[model samples]
Target: MHQIKRRSFLAATGAVLISPRLTAQPAEASQPGSLGASVTIEREPLHALPRTQYGHFLEHLGRCIKGGVWAEGESEDMFLGGIRRELLAEMRAVKPALIRYPGGCFADGYHWRDGIGPRSQRPLRKNLAWSRLGQKLGPEEDNHFGTDEFLRLCEELGAEPQLTANVGSGTAAEAAAWVEYTNGPKDSKWGSERVKNGHPEPYQVKYWFIGNEILGWHELGWQKPVQYVETLKRYAQAMRRVDPGIKLLASGTFGPNPNHAEIHQTLLQGAGDHFDYLSVHLYATEWVAPRNLWRYQILNRQRRPSRGLYYEIMAALSVQQQYLEDCISDLRQFSPAGKPIKLSFDEWNLWYRGYSDLYQSNFNLRDGLWVASALNLHHRYAQELELANISQMVNCLGLIVSTNQGTFPTASALVFRIYTENVGDELLPSQVDGPALPHPTGLPVLDVSATRQGDTLALFLVNRHLDAEVSSRCTCQGLQVGTVAKRVELHHPDAFKYNTYADPRALRISERSETLKVESDGAASRFSVQLPAHSLTCLVLEAKNL
Candidate 1:
């Protein structure tokens, strides 16, 4: 792991090194009559970008657990806890802030008891979530990877464990018991059971989700808005009785829909005081077909609209961000006085049609750009979005894909690495004045977020344009720019390009030193750089006088 230098800023100069495949047009081919994009960074600091925003999720579905992180058979390279040593190493490298376990609808039907106790004695149960619709039921869950194992994995990776308790098929007593086992004192009954399970000390997990999408009809025991709110209150009350310090996240909306409004209203009115965070899930997919069968048939017979899929996804993300803000406002209006509710975007990613049989999504360079933009959105809305988890951590919409042979870090993983490594502590507001992109609702060609820590500042930018490279001038108002500290770019010639085991380097991050020039007047220093089309870049700079 490369340690990020805390105090110093490094700079890189020249045109960004672009992959030959992606750079079909020369840098001189700027849009006709287009002015250079300019970004102004405000000195006033927003709240610290919560570390918890850099979290990941893990579910029991598919190879994410049984074969991905926890290998069944022992090998020389396996960790002592029977997990894949290679996966652990990869997870540690990203320094994920949290890992939500046993879910994404799976939690709604899961029975915590089935996973506790001796592995040999653990029973194999049918997984109702990840199975084919009408063919075979889901695979058998051996109950090998349960609560304890999850806590251990979090410990190994220095991540907090965010457990989603079963509210669909399990009762409040069961949820309370799981909490007791995890955090109750030694004298408590379930705590004693924890000792019997060979863990004498409590896991002291801080984050817990009440349920996993219980309002969705596809969930195991889907409930109506009112019913789910009542259940959430009961579960939150019971679990808090077991451990009062734990933070509970109530399952929120799927998106900006009528059900979303009703659900949030009911939860805030009925159970607002019980939970700390409202969990929401966001997944974007390109328009594959028309809504009507005739239109779809006609469109399919003609030609699929391949262009602007990336921009469409980005526009959807922008809409989702607005929806989230509206939800937060509703929470404020509905909650009791002095009680506040924040957002936990626990599930988010670019999920589309091409998923493997094992539920793994083929993440591509376009997806990496989407991840970068989505992360910037989170940072932009950092105040309301207290926590977020990128759907799954391994093999299932994950940044890292695990196989029988080894683990491969996807292009999206490099985005995670870059942000987690380079982003500063406090988010600073930044505005970009640039030419508009044709798609994705005419969003600016340059999307940016800035962060500051003492004398250092980091800028994260995503050029949303598909065909034109953006030349942008950045000016920091309050801070004097001394030097360029580091420049990291993640891009490829082909937006659809993805990483595979055969050629894992197909889309990866590149680092180069770029020149930084101080403005002649020295009032506010500026830097110039060209942002590649469909790319994400991070630039670190040092403050001159601080």
Candidate 2:
């Protein structure tokens, strides 16, 4: 038997343990590979990267809301507000701009009334939507983390509250009342009820989602495209009657699924005039049978670079991006009046592998790289994507995982922070000239996106190569490349490595300042960077002149 460190053993076996630091120091510089790429970032801005694009989601199902975020027992500190203090601190650090609550499938069945009263008085209802496989009802949903709690959590985290209303089993009047309760004046009936619940002032939630995946077969109240269009229009009209100022989002297709084209067409034809944003959900995963879970795990452990899983995932995203563009084009044709219908990619992540339940997913270093690539895709379609949320904030495909000891920010969370915390405001046009990979979809091994915020120019590069590092040179055409301010690289020796509760620092981000030799050619400036194999790197450069 091999002798392993206690923490390493525990981590390998999926045990929780806390680490002293979230990120580790960089490894020593080594010989670079022969692959060379050049990224040219156009200084002229294309579009503004909306802060809401960095939003997160919180669903009522699983441990995401219950044990993960809201604590049940007494805390040593009263000010902790019954929620996990550590989770709260971690959320604050990541600084998500917006958080959508009570949802995915849970939104279809949730009632606002059940969650608003005092904790003891709140009802324990059966979660009909997100139940275990072969089981009619999932877990007993104790309405502990209801509307008030979600709003309070958002407030605590300094995130804008985006609420999803129940349209499946809920009445239009109920949906209207929820809007009133959240945004109406205290004199209003539902608003007065909200005031009585201790929040005298309205929560003033700005974004409201009509339903969640109402067209999917697994959804609680699955309906045809035509049926959902009418349902969405009714819900939108009623809700907006109460507060017309609130932005309404209608549930959209799962991206590029042929079966959903009708849904997209019907939605634009019928409900397009009512809603401001069309919400799309995408989850990337290599499917395997539930019975073959153990076998799949073994195979995953032994899988080689030939698997091409990473490239496949990136290519799939590109396909989805094209699908989104097609949807936008359809929207343009449907509403010739030029009524803008932005996409709200509210639920997205890599969630293929299942554990005790379908909602749970294991996050690894590869998943972090996948997330980085996904963020890059979002940047590519920044103009179309008004808002996006990484599904289930604390658990259930969450970026941060909660344990009994505390909360651990996973590899995905670090990637989220690296982009959400450091990426610039204005997205710049960037083109990568590099060798293509062997995948059927010939995507460059070097994936890159650039942004400019005032005097700072940030380049987000993802080396999609599974085995080889790329030494790349970046050229800024519009702006002169000044001194390198920060270079944050996230990579692990083994792509399979992940951050577990016991080893929270296993796959961590490493940040360091790099000396850049800026060569100025009459109009453009160029600098060099080395992207490690299977790594996500963000280089922030200070422009020569503001």
Clash tally, candidates in order: 13, 4
Q: Which tens-of-lDDT digit does each residue in 337-414 have in candidate 1? A: 788788898877765432232356557777788788889889977887889998778987778988687677887888
* Model 2 lDDT tens row, 353-393: 44432344457777788788888888878887879898758
Positional deviation of 438 in candidate 1, in angstroms? 1.4
Candidate 1's TM-score? 0.89
lDDT over C-alpha atoms for residue 516 of model 1:
79
Q: Model 2 scores what on Cα lDDT? A: 0.75
Model 1: worst 10 consecutive residues (lDDT sum): 9-18
Q: Tell me the RMSD of model 2 versus the true structure.
A: 8.3
Those runs of model 2 whose alpha carbons end farther than 4 Å from true positions after fitting are 1-32, 78-80, 132-137, 288-315, 355-359, 544-546
Off by over 4 Å in 1: 1-35, 132-137, 288-305, 354-358, 520-522, 544-546
